[model samples]
Target: MDFLERIKARKSCLKACETTVTTVSGHSYMEKILADGTSVISWPQASTSPGYVIDTKPDLQVAHVLPGLCMGSQDVAHDFGLLKNHSVTHILSLGVKPVTLDQMLNYTYVQLLDLPETNLISSLDQCFIFIDNARQSGGCVFVHCNAGISRSASVVIAYLMRKESMNYQQALMHLKNIRPVIKPNPGFVQQLKDYEKMIFTLDGK
Candidate 1:
């Protein structure tokens, strides 16, 4: 990167690096937010077995899209704790049923809307509402289903496009930084491109 870009990147990195000082023999874990302003979910493991850590940048508000069963109690709790550091105050699950605090911490959101299905259009419409509320409240939000993939990424890109003025490529790259495998399904990716085109047509860009 250019010198100025490097400097700016470093500054953001510093801001996102909120390290946990305390350590527990087994429970303690350290996290540092990515330059995109999302948390890197890490837990140290024993020498015998190593596991992958979630190093995500919740640059913009986030979403999760998965089957109803994926957001179980344990995973919900994990996401809830990471939410604090990522500034994720509002949780939006695209699944039909809401994720209860049996595992994740309780969040007092204005409302949680469960849609009919995981179509691109449905995801976009829900994103509109969350983006509106989040902007008004000045709080971070999240969208998830099971694994943080296709549906999550699609809604996230919509939020970026409508709110952050990110073009398709830039928005996709940003999501990649947060979750490298954030590959929205082929059909969904096409829809996002179409959304970009719709904006371009309106703006004559």
Candidate 2:
């Protein structure tokens, strides 16, 4: 099926979310994060197609990590229309295989052979460089893997750690606060822990 058709079908089958997504003609909702670090979603009286969800149980889509960075599943990576709408300028793939989507024609693409059990510590620097360069250039980047949970999340966390000088726990908490579905594998988790020590020592932090 075409991308638009797939989106329509998915919307038709939408279920209840914590914010209670509705499709009533003219019904509206907005999501906001409060100053107390809590999020609340409320729907008012307005009308349009149901809003897109960043993360849904059993269903997957891209999630914004920062203003110029995002993480998502391979499905989101393939949806060229979505990427175009978001003005994504770069696509970083953490899967073993390269991205072969026709929709990626206009985007700079990078594929890294990052498996769940692979040694991510060695590759973290290269991944960070790619994402950092895009952000510095005022371009947006979307990183993805097969499931958008492990490999991609690891790369994002590593980037945050390097750029923000955050420890692993702090970075993980910040990511979960927004995406809420990132869970790196045990092996990756260990690597991230070791990485924290390595980077800290190098910088004398």
Candidate 3:
């Protein structure tokens, strides 16, 4: 199915995220900081139909209400018309593959990492490598998936837990703040709890 269709079908499943996502190259960049001290950004693509040029400059930030889940365009993500000043190096894709739709044409950031689907165990694995790479690079990490809901949030949550040492609730709050639309599947959430419990058991917590 088309990317737009996928978003329309799952809009209700996403939660309310109040964080600001900047639209630079037509793509959306939802920014957040994880417990690991690694800078986390969610590239939800915002929407399909592109609209007005919001902001441009030394301090550019945007608050958007998304109608769907599919990504915007990479042209918009790399449009530098507004992002010329900032430097993007790390990219984290929660989706099995990047570029869901015919969006990200030629735009390329610096480094890209892909994680498996969202679940307690998979999330932990995804973050182990994701955070390590982010620390090694000292650059920002951009993460996205089909819809940026479950898969992206789960992995990012794990990163928050490990790096920032935030508890599950605390980490989840950060995710919601950034992408008010992020609602991990109930099963996904349970899995994370299980994973957390497992860690506590192993660590004698």
Quick one: best lDDT, which candidate?
2
- Candidate 2: what lDDT? 0.75
lDDT of 2 by residue, 1-205 (tens): 9999897776666543444455545466776655443568886777655455445454346688888898877777767778778778888777545455664333444454445577887777777778878888888988887787788888899888888899999989988887787889888998899888987999998
Model 3, 130-192: lDDT tens digits are 546654655434445445566656766766666566778887887677567677777767766
Q: Please report, as a residue range, the 10-residue window in candidate 3 with the lowest summed lDDT.
A: 62-71
Rank order (by TM-score, best first) = 2, 1, 3
RMSD of each: 17.6, 18.3, 20.8
Best by TM-score: 2
How far off is residue 13 in model 1, in Å? 64
Off by over 4 Å in 3: 1-86, 99-120
Cα TM-score per model: 0.52, 0.64, 0.49
Ordered from best to worst lDDT, the candidate numbers read 2, 1, 3
The lDDT of model 3 is 0.50
lDDT computed for candidate 1: 0.56
Candidate 1: list runs displaced more than 4 Å. Answer: 1-79, 102-118
The C-alpha lDDT values of all candidates are 0.56, 0.75, 0.50
Clashing residue pairs found in predicted model 2: 26-46, 26-47
Instruction: Evaluate residue 44 in candidate 1 and report its C-alpha lDDT on the 0 to 100 scale.
Output: 60
